[model samples]
Target: MLPPVKKDRVITQLPQCFSPNAALHTKDGFHPQVKAMCQFQRTATVSFNIAKVIVVGDVAVGKTCLISRFCRGAFDKNYKATIGVDFEMEHFEVLGVPFSLQLWDTAGQERFKCIASTYYRGAQAIIVVFDLSSVNSLAHARQWLEDAMKENDPSSVLLFLVGTKKDLSSPDQLSQIEQEAIRLSEEIKAEYWAVSAKSGDGVREFFFRVASLTFEANVLSELERSGSRHVGDIIRITDNTDGHRRRKRTPQCC
Candidate 1:
C-alpha cells in the first residue's frame, strides 16, 4: 500500500516578546479572534495568505544578515551591498492555517533608493534595521521610514525598528541607543527589537513574532471582508427612471 502523504512542519506557539512596551502586542499567544476563525475554517485551506514585508534602512546596517539569519539560519560576516532588492519566501502555519511572508530586502544606498522605492507599495509590514553600535545609522531610521511610507498607508502597515549587531554594542552604547530607539519606536508607532545575527540571538524569535502578527492581521482582514457577504443571500439593484439606483437584499431562491 502507498504511504500517506506527510504534512509540512510549521511553528505552533506564538512567539513571546523581547520587550512588552516595544512589542506589537503584549499578549503571549495568538488573539482570540484569530483562534476562533481558525476553528470556524478548520476544514478549509486559506491559500495566498502572503504578507509582503519590506526591509529598509541605511546601508551596511545588517539588513541582509538579519533576514538571512532567520530565514536561512546562517550569518555571513561579509557585507555585499544589495542591488535594488532581494527576495525570500518564508512559510508558517498559524492556528492551523497556512500563512507566508514575502521578505523583500531593499537596497539602502542613495543611488538605489529610487530603484528600491518602486517596490515599497502594498507592504503589510516594514522593518527598518540599523546597526546598534552605530549611532549614525540609528539617526537615519526616520528618513528610511519616511521613504517607505510614501508607497504604503501608514495606518495599515505594521512598523518594526530593529537594532542589529547587538553583540558589538557596549553596555553603555547599547543602553543609550536602546533608549533612543524606544523613543523613536514610540514616535513612529513601530515595535522595537534588538538582535545579533552572529549569535542568532533574538533572530528566530523576532521573525516568528513578525510571522505571527502578520498572519493574524491577514486573517482578521479576511474576516472583515467576508463578514459583509452572507451565505445564501444576494443583493438586488433596481434603477429608477430619474437615474437613481436602489439596492435591496434578498435570500437566494431554492
Candidate 2:
C-alpha cells in the first residue's frame, strides 16, 4: 500500500539540516529573501514547479533502497537490480507553494551506463550515492558526478553526495570513511549525508533537504526572470529565460 502523501512528504516549514559542515544552508531556515517573497508576493502561475533529480552510483550501493525508504517508507529485502531507469514523482508544499521533485533512479551496472547517461540531461540536481562500508564506491563518486554534469550546465545544478548503509558501518570504520567522504564532498562542492535505509534513519531528512533547496532555487530563478518583484539590490529580476530586456542604468551609491 502507498503511504499517505501529507504525513510523509508535506513540508510546511523550511527543513533543517543534519550537519553544519555538509549543509547547503548553514542557518536554521529558508533564505530571508525567499521567505519574504512567499509572505508578501502573490503566487505566480508557475509553469515549472517540477525539478529533475538524478541518482547515480555503483551497483548494489543502496540507491534503490535509499529512494524506496523515503517514497514508500519500506525497504525491500528481496533486492532486484534497477534496469535502465526508474522514476518517481514526490510532491511537497514548501511555504504554502506546491512543489514536486522528479527522481530519476538510474541503473548502476556497466551495461546500462549508456542508457542511463542519455537521461542525465536537464537535471536540476545530481545525487551521487555510495555505500558507507565500501571505500571503492566512495572513490567512484567523482566519476559519476562528472558524467552527470556533462549533460547540464554546472552553474544551474545542485550536487549532493550521500553515503548509504550507515547502520552496517562500525563506529571506527564509519569515522574513517566519513573523513574521506567529507574531503571528497568538499572537493566536489556537494552536500554530504549518511543514511541507513533499512533502519529508516536520515532518509527522510535528506530528501526533505533536497526538496527544500531545489524549491528555493527554482523560485529564486523565477523571481530573477519575472522582474516584477524586488528582493534586494543584489538580485534583479529583469527578463524571463526566453525573453530579453535591457537593464536601466542607475546612479551608483558612493
Candidate 3:
C-alpha cells in the first residue's frame, strides 16, 4: 500500500482566472466534497498523479535553499553541501484538483554526482538552478542539465532554467545574465525564471507554475489514453418534465 499523504504545506492560491469553487471530478461519480472524505480514508490505496521533480545545479548554487523556501517557507544561510539526495513532498490544489509533487534535491558536488545521478531516473520535471551573481555557475548549468537528463527520457521531461539568489545580483548583472539565460533556455527548449530563495521572491510563483504545467500535462495524457472523448467535449442533459435540455459535461480532474 502507498503511504498516507502527510498534511504538509498547501499551495492553493491560484490565479484570478481559476475559480476556487470550480467543480471537481470524482472516480465514483459522486460530489467532490463527499469523495474527498472517502479519498482521505483510503489514502493508502488511492492512486493519484504524482509529478517527480529533480533539482540540479553546481555546488552552492542555492538549489537546497530554493527547495527549502518552497517546501518549508524558510531559508537557511549556513552553507552545507548535500550528501547525496534529499526528499520533499508538497501537496497542491490546482483548479479544484488534488495533485502532489515529489521533489528531489540532488547533490551538486562532483564527488556526489554519481550518487545523485542514480536518483534522476523517472523524473517528470528537471529544474536546473544557477546563481545569478556567479556567471561561472550559470555557465555550468548546461553540464548540470546534461547530467540529470542522462538517465531520464529527455523528450518526455519538462525542463526549467532557474536563476537563484536574484536579490544579490545588480540590475546590470541581472540583465546581462537574463539575456544569456533566455538564449540558453531557447536553445535547450526549457522555461526560464529568476528567483530569490533568501528573499522569497518568485519562489512560490515558480513552483505554482510547475504544478500547473504538470497537472495540465497529466490531464491531457489521460484524455488521450482514454480515447473516448477529447478535451472540452460536451454532453447534453435533458429534463423530461419541462421538456428542457441543457448541455453539461463532467469536469475532468486527474
Candidate 4:
C-alpha cells in the first residue's frame, strides 16, 4: 500500500518537503543487475558514463506519460496511480563515447509527495514538466524546481522547464503559455521548452542538451574536488579472444 500523503508539507517546495522522508523500502522498478555483472566479470574494455537523472512535475501533467514515451517510445492513455517512483535505464552512444542514464519518474500526485523527493537528491539533471492547458500547473513548476534543487547539488543540476501537452496547444493558447514559461524561466534562471510528449517532440533534444550539460558538470565537479583542471581518460588493455592484449578507451573525467 502507498503511504498516506502528508498534509504538513509546510515547505512550499515539495522536493524540500521530501527531504525528511528517506527512500521507500520498496525498490519498485529499480534494477541494478549490471552492477553485479561488472563486479563479477573481468571486462577490460567496458566503457560508459553513468549518471542519475530525475523527472518531476505536478500531478497529471503527464510525468508518467512523458517518461513512457521517452524511454519506451510509447504511451498509455489509461489511468494507473504510480504507487511510488518508477525507473528506467537507457544506454546510448554519443560522440564516440558510451553513456548510460538512470531515469527516475516520480509520482506527481499530492499524496505521493513523501516518496518523490528522496529520489531527487543525487540527480545530475532534472526535467520539470508542466501542462500547457493548465495555468495552475505552470505556476507550480517553480515549486517543483525548488524542491528538486533543495535535494540536489545546485551547482550541477541541469534543470529544464518543459511545457508538455503541446499537441493541445492552439494559436490562442500558444502566446500566453510561451510568455509565462519564458518569464518564469528568467525568474528562476532555467531553460524552457514547449514539447508534445505524445508526439515525442523536443524529448530527444531535451536530454541531449542535458547530457551535454551533465557531461560538463561532471568534469567541473571532479576538478573542483581534486583541484585539478584536467580530467583524465581511462585506457584499459586486456588479452583478446584469439590474440594479444587489446586496448580500450573511455573518458575518465576528473
Which regions of candidate 3 deviate over 4 angstroms?
A: 1-47, 229-254
| Per-model TM values vs. the true structure | 0.84, 0.84, 0.73, 0.70
Question: Residues 130-206, candidate 3, lDDT per residue (tens digit)?
Answer: 99999999899998898888899886788888999999999999989988887887788777888999999988878
Candidate 2's residue-wise lDDT over 144-174, tens digit each?
A: 9999999999998999999999999999999
In candidate 1, the residue pairs with backbone N, CA or C atoms under 3 Å apart (3 or more residues apart, or in different chains) clash, namely none
Candidate 4, residues 29-80, lDDT tens digits: the string is 2123222222332334444455677888888898878767766678787857
Question: Model 4, poorest ten-residue lDDT window?
Answer: 10-19
Clashes of 1: 0
Query: Which runs of model 1 end up more than 4 angstroms from their true locations?
Result: 1-9, 228-254
lDDT per model vs. reference:
0.78, 0.80, 0.69, 0.61
What's the ranking of the predictions by lDDT, best on top?
A: 2, 1, 3, 4
List, in order, the clash count of every candidate structure: 0, 1, 0, 0
Among all candidates shown, the one with the greatest lDDT: 2
For candidate 1, give the lDDT: 0.78
lDDT (tens digit, per residue) of candidate 1 on 1-254: 11121143265768887777877778777778777666655555333356889999989999999988877779999968888888776766666655567788888889887778888999999999999999899999999999999999997899999999999999999999999999999889899999999999999889888888887876667667678542111111112122221212222222
